[model samples]
Target: MGAQHDKMEVGDLKQEANRASPVNIIVSPDGMMYDYLNLPGRVIINEEVGASGESLSTRKPVKIEKLYEYVSALRSNSFKFLLREYEELCEISPQCPQTVGLSEINQSKNRYGNIVPFDHSRVRLKPMMGKESDYINANFIPGYKNARAYIASQAPLPMTVNDHWRMIWQQRICIIVMITGLVERGRRKCELYWPKPGFPIKYGLVEVTNIKEEVRLDYLVRILRVKIGREKSPKSRHPILIHCSAGVGRTGTYVAIDRLIQEIQAKHRNVDIFNTVYDIRKSRSMMVQTVRQYMFIYDFHLDAWQIEGDPEGFKNRKMVERQKELDSKYKELTSKDDLMVEQKATYDLYELFLMAACCCCPFLFDKN
Candidate 1:
């Protein structure tokens, strides 16, 4: 009897083990390199993903890359699931503005003109808003909580250089992002739009003063001062203008990154990069052009958590959606003619009591 009991116990243990999760390892890549996470043994690349395994590090507001991984872990599927979710969402999303002509105001500069901001989202240059002038291919993409709102535009050409500055002045812009180099792969990408350090440049009524330039391995950040040199009242919206060769690839990527960074900072483990990008693309269809660029946002956030151990509004949204489904199901169950007929006597008595009670205590029922 003891031997047989031991054998049964061993069989039960094996069955439970079989039911456990098979993904003992998690892998995440940040464009250049990969980080592996081991769950069963608590060893990732021979080092702990987080040394303490608690939210020990008190990083300020948190960074996007790290925040993404923290939330991914909370979802229990890791970073891979996040990337797959984004890819599937984008793949299923319908490509809008089906006709190419609907997006383009100028046909010469852009090939297959990536839409000039949607009419509702377009930033009209004050100088050309009502005047007879070609449109500046630029858009204002609003981010979550109004964080990192941006105006994405193409690299200004020689003829449209003044128009680009006009858009900046009209929008009271502050930052100018030049993602593509002046010349890339022996091709002229964008005209030098900013003024030389000490020498201020003029374009129509706008004056561009290069205030600061911070260089990085991936991209450049330049602070620009655009003054109409005529407005009486002060407006505090210094909208950022981002541009690449065609204002589609790097331009969109940078814009999306800014929004993600701000959202992760604001919401911590609650924000969704996929939905954020989707919102931007709704306004400017070409934002975050490639799957690789989209994946990079996930990688960027994952890497932010690499140095230290880290920490779901996303799950709550899903819960709310599921609640809606349950509500509909309940409505169907209660409103069916068969159910009403089957329980008419009991339900009618209950309704009578409810109505009488409501009449007796008016405050118990909603007035509005």
Candidate 2:
């Protein structure tokens, strides 16, 4: 009776193990990978095909050898799941002290009441003679090595223009990367804190002179007396100030890209973006606010890899087309849909990614 019971127990354990097994992955004939997620609907093979109606090879070029692993990780079935996991972690993570930012004296300085910097990471400006408070709605977001590498701040309000310039002057900030315009969708997103080109504006004791303005297809560059560079110079030692409307979403995205660029340049591989954004969120709440922004980091990193791989500028026609496609995708993500219905949109993207993962190399997704 004991021997029979042991055999039955072993059989039950095997059944349980089978139930816990991962989904079956298969490789398509066209070199694409696919993950059979066992969804009720039929598998819709949405892929980019050539003129001959054959699926284009999804393999990475030898030039981007280092990115092979990274690319595989992005295309894995688990990638989206990991993104979702990290996002949930961000919600439940231990928060730093925000008492100073929430205090009555500093309440009016914040652009959005809820989006305040933690006391430990907040930037402190020199207290002016008349103004007793040395507070700014900004936090010191760390980079690869520097703890105070970047100052993530909210867009300046009309009332806080002087405080903005004061923080800039006190920090000796060289570059100001403004990610939003003065207005968006008939709403005032940020205040014009700088003077017009060829004009000098004095905010508090600091004078900002706009020397030149260069307009491009998508963005405009303004040459200001406050120089922009990350050299070892004393003037450039201060953290580079980056701000958007609320300062978390776009600022965090840009900061992540900056950190990844540095990492890729130094090592060319082993880049962990999940952990990168995780650390950023630890410093400030909702840094990379949405999954769309998180996906944009992947897109930007892929583009960077391509550009870096082919230093000779000998990209094929397919590469150029891919670049254009990424650019179009960037524009779409920046639209109002990203702000509204983001949860739905992100899940929709996850579904598409899972489909693509089914068509990719299974070895890349292998845990071993």
Candidate 3:
């Protein structure tokens, strides 16, 4: 009788906690429950709840009206919220071993011994010149929609330059986003892999030429023309190579910000920094490596919301009109096809349009 009484007390406490909890628990038909911190959204299939229960992966429009309200509330305690989230992420983030990257045969291929890619997700180069081993210190990172949208790699060392180009050529990568200098603070962070503008250099059989470079106040954009033997590099939605000295710090931060920007533009309402970092770290450990970097992601999103969330700020602008047109078209396309694949394609196209705008008109975007 005493044991039964104790069980009843335990059940009562759990019920009380659930009632008092601020989070909303969403249970799908399959009995899978998803919890969000005060996030409210319309119920859908629920099998495909997105970063903040937005259901971006589905064709049907997921209600995100409450996300703006949540963001406003978050803004009131942004720093404190992010700090607590970061601490929690550090404790729960999963990681894998760098077995192959640290193997004796491939040790020299890594720029830093401690900063190696997970064996499971590392990019594998084709065996060349009769060499049996294929290795590079890089991992495939997922983008907002694409699973293999970006490659996070350590900056190339002197010996591994050829391998870097080989991976790029093999992967048919169109974009290369480097976030480090050749040297920093009296330390060599990366080796110069690209030729001078208008000059061509051959790394192994791959010929790379920097066709043009545009220098801005804060960032420089380079257009590269690459060729491999008889075939010229074709443009496609291939994985972009993004590297920093350690590959996880600035690389991760840049990728996170890029993904979040796409999310904000796509949904136009919600932003989930904690899950973004958590998801990226699962792919490549230690992504957004520092607390300051994590905070920067939040800062960037808040700044972006100021512009993107303001309908009046972009009134009478072509970008806004285009956005509205896309929204209408996206709804039409989703209604007709009713397939996830089609929905994904439309989402990717929308994200590409926003990225192109940011690239073409840096003045329009606040680079802070």
TM-score of each: 0.55, 0.66, 0.65
Clashes of 1: 5
The global C-alpha lDDT for each of the candidates, from Candidate 1 onward, is 0.48, 0.58, 0.60
What does the lDDT read for residue 104 in candidate 2?
Answer: 94
lDDT of 1 by residue, 11-72 (tens): 11111112343222222221111111111333211111332265422123444444654444
The better candidate by lDDT, 2 or 3, is 3
Candidate 2 per-residue lDDT over residues 1-368, each given as its tens digit: 00001111101111121233332222222221211221233322223333335443323221245344444443344343323333344545447889998999889888887789988888888776575577889999998878888899999999899888778777877667777767764667889888887877777766777777876433456766642233221343567888878888778877886776565555545455666777887788778765556766666555555544553343653544765664465344233333333232333322322332312211011000
Off by over 4 Å in 1: 1-87, 94-105, 109-116, 128-130, 210-225, 228-237, 307-368
Instruction: State the displacement of the C-alpha of residue 356, model 3, in Å, after optimal TM-score superposition.
Output: 5.8
Worst 10 residues of 3 by lDDT: 1-10
Error of 3 at 40 (Å): 37
Candidate that scores best on lDDT: 3
Across 68-113, the per-residue lDDT of candidate 3 in tens digits comes to 3333333332222333345456656786888888789888877766
Q: Cα RMSD to native, each candidate?
A: 23.5, 15.6, 15.3
